[model samples]
Target: MKEQDTVDLFVIGGGVNGAGIARDAAGRGLSVILCEKDDLGEGTSSRSGKLVHGGLRYLEYYEFRLVREALIEREVLMNAAPHIIWPLRFVLPHSPDDRPAWLVRLGLFLYDHLGGRKKLPGTRTLDLQRAPEGAPILNKYSRAFEYSDCWVDDARLVVLNAIDAAARGATVLTRTPCISARRENGAWSVTTRNERTGETREFRAKVLVNAAGPWVNDVIQRVAGSTSSRNVRLVKGSHIVVPKFWEGANAYLVQNHDKRVIFINPYEGDKALIGTTDVAYEGEAGQVSADEAEIEYLMSAVNRYFKEKLRREDVLSAFSGVRPLFDDGQGNPSAVTRDYVFDIDENDGAPLLNVFGGKITTFRELAERGLGKLRTFFPEMGKDWTHSTPLPGGDMENADFESFQAKVKAEYPWMPRSLLQHYTRLYGTRLSRIVGEATSVDGLGRHFGGDLYEAEVRYLMDQEWATTAEDVLWRRTKHRLHLTEAQQAEFATWFSAEMREAA
Candidate 1:
């Protein structure tokens, strides 16, 4: 973090779009700096429904292009990070009240053919009365459609992009908010203050990029003192974590009376991640949380299809994110486009690229296209190269995570099954960075309850720029859900001492 540093590009906001653009620019042989007021993926990027789907429902809105591009990127991303992104079979029970079976069939048909889906199985019809996947569902629904989509660790995807960017000679500043930016002699002068250290540094960037998700307008009007006619529609979508009640590995998508669809997916090992209600939000982005109605709305959607009822006591935790959708004058929040829009403001000669409205599934593509918009400024910059490139820790051959998992299991015969899976899933090929010279459970260093270990914590701090306990537990990993309150507090105490000692 040198003061008065100059680079080819300076990216503000370290969410998926920001990190992805940073990674793309750095890999294309450009010097880059990415700053975030919070940890990477601490915003909407981490709060998604955790799916890399083609937005199956968007088909009804005639969003064929968006769905097709997303569908194609589904496998592209799955191949890029097989450890975090894998195929998920969603059993969408056909409901007579909301959507007719024929219409649902047509949507699934388009979903199958639209993306040139390679690597994933096609759609199949299932008889809910006889199929094992429907055992948990009510008997009233006798038919369902099974289709393919990919599950993603949304938070890790953002971190991996940042990691890749840093590896490619980009400087990443976390907990550092860009306070000001202005055109200065054919270049942009930016100032940022690190929240943790209270240290301010200056940068001279040839081009400035605003990837601030919900705060896109804030950065443009407030921070940069620049204006853009383009506006972002802030829509808040929330999800809840509850115990996995279903018996199979399959997930369920049920239609709601409001014409919205809810997904009930198996999450973490013993829990389920269910969510996403599209509601126009006016509150601050950082203050967004799952309201009682949203939670009940989600639970009720599940109860409509599942025989195993989910009560209020069954909910473990809830989270929400504010999606900064490109305002298209669509009054219905659900009708808003999931596709991204780029607005490049040429402030004299320096350029500021503002990204708006994209989904987790198409982040890489969004990033690539975003860089393409600024090709003229840096004509010497390298050509596009992220489509086939692998993110950090996603270097398995052909992205075969199952084979990689088996290989690691054999190497560490003494490691417990759950711990091994946890390390592999979160770190992929980079698991060795943390498990270096570790042979047994004790080799992993102090156990802080559940599968959490000091070695992993140290690795995260050393590699992932994790500054706070919440960053490590909630963002870097989901240990917050597993550790009891006392155990979590104890781990926090140890973490504080460790930080103090390191300082």
Candidate 2:
């Protein structure tokens, strides 16, 4: 074991919240280190609904503050990473059986004007019989409402934040578990073990942050050997991916018989991403998986509105995430608050900040505010600046991805449109680093089916913290969706050999 290295901040968890805070804190000139027990975003962050919108249903629960903050963050994040985070219009097919049209209209009205909405179009009424967006809907849905939100490559978002943090001089250690921590003479002495190498390291930090999402309590009690009065209620949410059934670029939201709404959004250019059941989860967060009942429930919601019915065979893949919601004593899991709570324990002159709950939309704001709570401890720390700054690969001119994409099309005219899109959308300005001087498809080295070329794989391994083939296939990129089983097996074999050679 190496000698203990001291840092200003030590963050536990590699989810969006943890990565976002690490980026924000590092940019403000704080010496920081972030450790994740598993692969980056292998936890709850990647298994999200992937929308960067204020929870519309949250409005019904009178979460105005959370909704407004999320709404404002939508545009802020959109500008920060236009490639991964872009506007998505949702068509809500009016259901007379679920809620009154007048009430729906009022909610839409508030949603249109609630937060600082710039760069995104406002909500408008849709004539289901005439509008193009309603072409795939059932005849019973005569009217619909359209509103704007943003979609994110949720896993990539976490990776980008970590990348930015690393670029700004923060140490990011993935697949490293913080085994123990103790307050020692007004500082935290933390020990972490690397799962892959079986090497343990220690760190001394002035402040410790637990953003372990679903594992928050486990870290509080088991890892740190401390307790907090605040608690996290684990609410499981799931999403199913299937081939794209509807037309146009619009997504659909339909209310289920149980009053919960399900999102059927266009995904990965050729598929639909449908989700999510809010069941109270009590098991291990890593073991949380979508059951048959949840899948059937989601399918029923989609079938009620879409003209093209979905079957079990249509489900290409399904994922589940446990929301670490702040326990507000709500009976229903869905009724639990999505708002984040910060519990700061400045006991024995050492500080430990535990984050309870947050959404993808408000992660930046949550990071900014979390840092604000620690300002008194570090009076000389830099001010909040992530709102106006661009994330890594998000420095497109004026945050215009369309124009930048057009330029990429011209530059890589020899490449397939799909491949070009894959690069630009995933890497943005950093696409050149992946492509390099490759002028043709053969220049990209081996073709592993679909758009999984050797160049991109090497770039992911060299730059991104991608070790295992599954890390690249599932989390770092969605290549698994496009590749066949045999092709995936081949890639996995090649990735294993390459990693061994590198070692």
Candidate 3:
């Protein structure tokens, strides 16, 4: 490998943790390279519950530190990416049979005071019989508790971090898998193969980071020929999307008889996202899906609290992701700690930082602290800076999304309200780059369906490293949900032809 090809850090995953670390390291003046076998966030990051929350249920396990850190990071992330991360209110109906009212109040109290909540509202008791939020709840639930959290466009979060990292001089390789990594001459030699072009490349790096999520162990044992005392427990969590049944922007949280909590959140304008069964999984992480029993369990839990019962036919789509949790010897998958752990293996002056078990809410802090573990090696690296800096497209004045929306409306009077809102919410201040000199809808090139325009697809291809239809349709954006099956097929054909012509 050429001397120029050598970097300060080599990251082996392109999920949120990997992307975040790459961004942080690059920003701190470290030459970094991030490689992923699939598209960014194709793993657990995109398939998350899509909330930047304090994990109210985690309090039951006495995870005070994890909950506190996540709570504090919520507003920090919202400030960093106002367009993609914003406040969401959750109404939890009082389930007297599952837990007593006082215990519920205690949990909510800690959730309110756990972190230094500045911008978000505190918790409040709700009269389900009188409040509009109670309209969908069954008559048995006459009271509820409402608390604040934030919703995130999880996939976009990963992409934006990668974009920011690349902007800061990090090399991002998607559709590329790290084939082998070995310590050599007090450094690391890493070889990666491009799955698309069958091209192989080599790099020399001073340090290696394995943030591979479900495949962290594979990267350790297979790719690096290294081992750690820590192991990741793969817990499968699934979510189902259906037509929106209730009347508000707020989400509903129900307590199951099994003592697990289920979130029924508003999703994608006209849909509801309900999910998450915590069944211990022993299969390939990529092959995990919502099994029949899991789907029925989720539906039954929602049916227990809601006046509108959901049937199997009502399910529009389902997705499952394996949580690469740090194994804590817990018998129940749900009881596994959501806290992140870094196993630093410093062998003869060469170091491998293996990250395990972190959620989207704590990715930034995880990156910051992960880099801190390597400070001794890179003594000349810059001080911490990502805390105050914004991610790509999030650099609006004061990180104020509503103000930016108003400005977009004023700037593009000819754009339809829905289209403008879509662009503004997804792209934020970066909307102009996608819009370019387009004066009308026709300038956006061919319309794929819904708000997916050719110009946006082109931007994603050129800027976001999107090489496949699913990269654009599912990971980078959720156009697949809106586009009909035939429409999706047509768009895929067009995308392939466009790529071929460009090539």
Candidate 4:
């Protein structure tokens, strides 16, 4: 944390990949420093589809290696962090007008048998008329396919990895951007300035990692003063949230006329998440927003199969994110690969590792492989260990979240079911850190409405580098969706006035 300290590794991003690398490197006995220009996951890492799947559609592009690795990593992540990730069933309604029945069946067959399958159920045919999953679907789709995938709290996953990295002896600097990095004396001279306090610091590191999601190319050209043949294409994906119109915990996937698929997922308890129009984006990653055309496209796709039509009034919220896909020269943005590529510039004695495209489902593995690329630099660093290690709060036995829930209920009997569920789902074993021997609702301190309390707020500020209310409400937890606009504004005012250090 000093101004001119020497470290083994210095990472230049705070997204999931960078956080994962920091955690891995720290556990392997490397002195690491991870600096972020904003709050953790305040970028593409947060605005993801929130699913850990094998990319069933990638099969059409013949990305067998990517699919197989992702499929294998799905269960690995589920085991490492069960609190924020759990199994979910996806119901895909068949349409003879789109893809042939045999092709769909063959794709599902490969999805079932492609990677080692053990924890989740295999695909099965469903009678649309009899199965409850198809009750809201139109009768034209008589048959459906039910497959397995995992749901993730994308922002929380990023924060947890950063937390674990910090706990493993890595310095995490939020709201601090690396302004300059130069290679001198076979080391990296990195200088960072704090955006909040106008404080500056410098460090000498043995290696530099450019895991700056959307800004990878920018870092190469501007920050590092280095050039690379590799590049990333920004693909904009948009999603809309609406009231839950269908029953059951299962989600629905419908194929659009353009051959792209849309997911209708149960979200925030009483709402549905439908998304993703893949369009080539040239705008800023931070300024991305769901356009009217993208929103209309999502609704239209949902209406194609669902009997309950979705109008503009039903849309509660909408968000958009740009994917930093590795440019494969494909004209269609949807056809681009999600696989990651690495470029190592070992010129002039120092090394700069540039990470290209990657998806959330393969972040941990990506980190492992990223570290493997630096094996020559740190020969004495520890071997791979994240495979079985539990992240900060994901230490449940057998990763049984249901069993953990029962235990929590018995322990915090005084807590309401809704509040308990929220805390347990977000914090897991770390719930006690916030609860801290309090009894009853009043003991949790002033309620900010909808399970938002002073205790949780203080915990996030102290531990998770939460400087603003948006970090807590929108990113750390979805309290913004549950709380009214007035409540949110009041919380923001209270947070700013009461929390003087943050200001």
Candidate 5:
């Protein structure tokens, strides 16, 4: 393995936490190398509720610190990537049969004042018959409460972090899995195998960080040949995407009979993204899927609240992700702590930091704290700086996407409105790089239906680590959802040919 590349820190996993840590550490002037077994955020990170909120439900469990940190992070993340993360209002219709009104009100009040909320609006009471937000709810619900949270393009957030890290002089390797690691002469020797070319490479690092979300134990025990007292419990959560049934951009949160709340959010432009059931999972994390019972349970919860009923046929797609929660000896999976814990083992002079649990909303703060834990080892490292910095393509002035969209429209007056909006929303300040010198649609090359064109695919390949059609279609961009099956097949054929030609 060519005498192994030496770095100050080595991170395993390409999920949000891993990417965030890489960006943070790289910005702090530390040499970093991050390797992911598959595409960035192909794991549980992309398959999240896609919200950057304080987790209102956690208030009941008295997780004051966790909630407060996450609450503050919501605005921090929003400013970091205004194009992808924006404020969203959730309407929770009051149901007397469920939790009492006073309890819900108290929870909302605490949520309002718990963290230092600056940009987002606080909760407000709503009368069902008068307010527009309550129009979609069933007649039985007479009152509701609306509160603020931020929605995120979870997959893009991870990719953007990686981009930012690489820009700050960090080495990033996707589709590369860590084969093994061993401590040697006050340092650690790690070897990774590239899945694409079947090539093995080695690295020497002073510290190793394991941010593998669902595969935390696998990396610790099998890959690193180390042991820890901490353990991770795999809890599977599933989401089903269906046709939109309500008006307005607001999302609905209904409390189920089992004391769990389900979110029905407006997704993509004309679809609804409803999720997520909590079930103890004992199988392989990669094999987790949404079962019929889970689908029925979710549909029933939505049907009980909305006037427009949803059926089995309405489900357009479904996805599942396993939460690698720190096992706190809790029997109920729902009651399990979403807070993260670090198990730093410095037995053989070198250090191994194993992150057990974390949520998408708290990844940034978790990264900052994770780096802080390693401060004693590397006192020469730079100070914290990611909270105020913008992610790749998120350099809009004042983080105002609306004004940025207007500027894009004015610049690309010849482009179609839909295409302009798509590019502006996804790329923000970086749109010019993608749409360079193109004054007409023909300049974008072949069109594959919808808003996808050859120019965009080429941009993803040249800039992003989009090696396969699925990588571009599913992760880097959600073109699969909008393209027809035949169009997708054609695009795949073209993409494969282009890759072979490049090779």
Candidate 6:
């Protein structure tokens, strides 16, 4: 191994938790490297329900610490990346058959006060018969409750963390898997193979962080050749996207007969994203998909409350991801805790920190706390600072997204409103970097489809570590949902040729 390749830390995942930890450690002046087997957030991080909420149902499980921590993190994350994380109101229709109104009210009350509620409004009792938000609900539900939570672009959140980590002097390697890691002479000898180039790299690190999400155990046993008393439970959650059925910005949460909750949220400007059935899964996390039975289950859940019924044909797309919850001897998958657990195994003075379960909302805090556990080893590292810092492209004045949009519009009056909004929503303060000196849509170079132009593609390739067509279409942005099949194929062909030429 080359002496120059030695570092203080090596993180083995590109999901939210892993990326967040790399960013935190790098910002604290630690030498860091983050490796991902696939694209950033190609796993559970991107497939989430996309809500930065303090799981209200967890209240029934008495997970107060997790709920409170997540609630507090909502505002903290919004301030960090206001463009992608913003407050959203959810309307819950009263269904007396599922639970009593008082129980629901009590849960809302705890949600409102638990995290030092500020910026977001408190809960309100709604008269569904009279309110505009109730227009789409069936008249049988005459009452509702409205509360606040935040929505996030999940995949982008992971990418932005990686970007920030790189900016802070962290080496980030995507499409690279840690092939082997072993404790030798009180240090970790790690080896990774780049899938695209078929190149192998070696490194020596003082500490190893295994934030591999669904593959946590794989890294522990297979890669590091170590064992842990802790185990990970794989739980599959799926979501379906369809055309917008309702006319409001607020989302709807309905209680199911199985004592679970379903979220119907507005998505990608004229689409509705509904989802999430929790089933204990034993299959490979990478090969998981929404089956017919799961799809029918989701459709039935949505049809129970909305006036516009959802049919099989209405689903435009469906995706599934597996959550690696820490096995706590829970019988029901839904009852599994979303809280994170860290197990540090010091094998002959070399430490391997294996991160178990964590949701997106608390990733920053999780990173901070994870690093805190390693303070005795690196006491000279910098103190916690991510709490008040703004992420890249999120440094708008006071984190005001609307004001930033107005500024971008003033700067580029010739840009179409739809495309401008797309740029601002995804890039925030970095819109100018993507638009450059382009005076009109024609200046943006080739138009793939919808709002996707060649300039944005180049920016993604140059700055965001995007390589494949799928990386740009699905994760970096949701252009896949807007473009036709032929347009997609054409874009893929063009992108491959351009990448080959650049290489």
- Compared with the true structure, what per-residue lDDT tens digits does model 2 show for residues 1-503? 77566788999999999999999999999999999999999989999999999889998999999899899998899999998999999999999999998999898888888897778898899998999988888998899989888899999999999999999999999999999999999999999999888999989999999999989999999988889999999999999999999778999999999989999999999999999999999899999999999999999999988888999999999999999999999999989999999999999988999999998889999999999999988899999999999998999999999999999899889999899899989999999998999999999999999999999999988888999999999998999999999999999999999999998
lDDT of 3 at 110: 96
Residue-wise C-alpha lDDT for candidate 4, range 17-64, written one tens digit per residue: 999999999999999999999989988988988999999999999999
Off by over 4 Å in 5: none
Alpha carbon lDDT at 384, candidate 3: 92
Candidate 5 local lDDT, residue 368? 95
**Each model's TM-score?**
0.99, 0.99, 0.99, 0.99, 0.98, 0.99
How much lDDT does candidate 2 score?
Answer: 0.93
Q: Where in model 2 is the C-alpha error above 4 Å?
A: none
Report the candidate with higher lDDT, 1 versus 4.
Answer: 4
* Reference-based lDDT, each prediction: 0.92, 0.93, 0.93, 0.93, 0.91, 0.94
What is the Å distance of residue 73 in model 3 from its true position?
Answer: 0.5
Q: Tens digit of lDDT per residue, candidate 1, span 460-479?
A: 99999998898899999999
TM for candidate 1 is: 0.99
Model 3 C-alpha lDDT versus the unseen true structure: 0.93
Model 5: colliding residue pairs: none
Positional deviation of 257 in candidate 1, in angstroms?
Answer: 1.2
Model 6: runs farther than 4 Å from truth?
1-3
Q: What TM-score does candidate 5 get on C-alpha atoms? A: 0.98
Candidate 3 weakest ten by summed lDDT: 1-10
Relative to the true structure, candidate 3 reaches a TM of 0.99
Compose the digit string of candidate 6's lDDT tens values, residues 133-224: 98889989999999999999999999999999999999999999999999989999999999998988889999999999999999999999
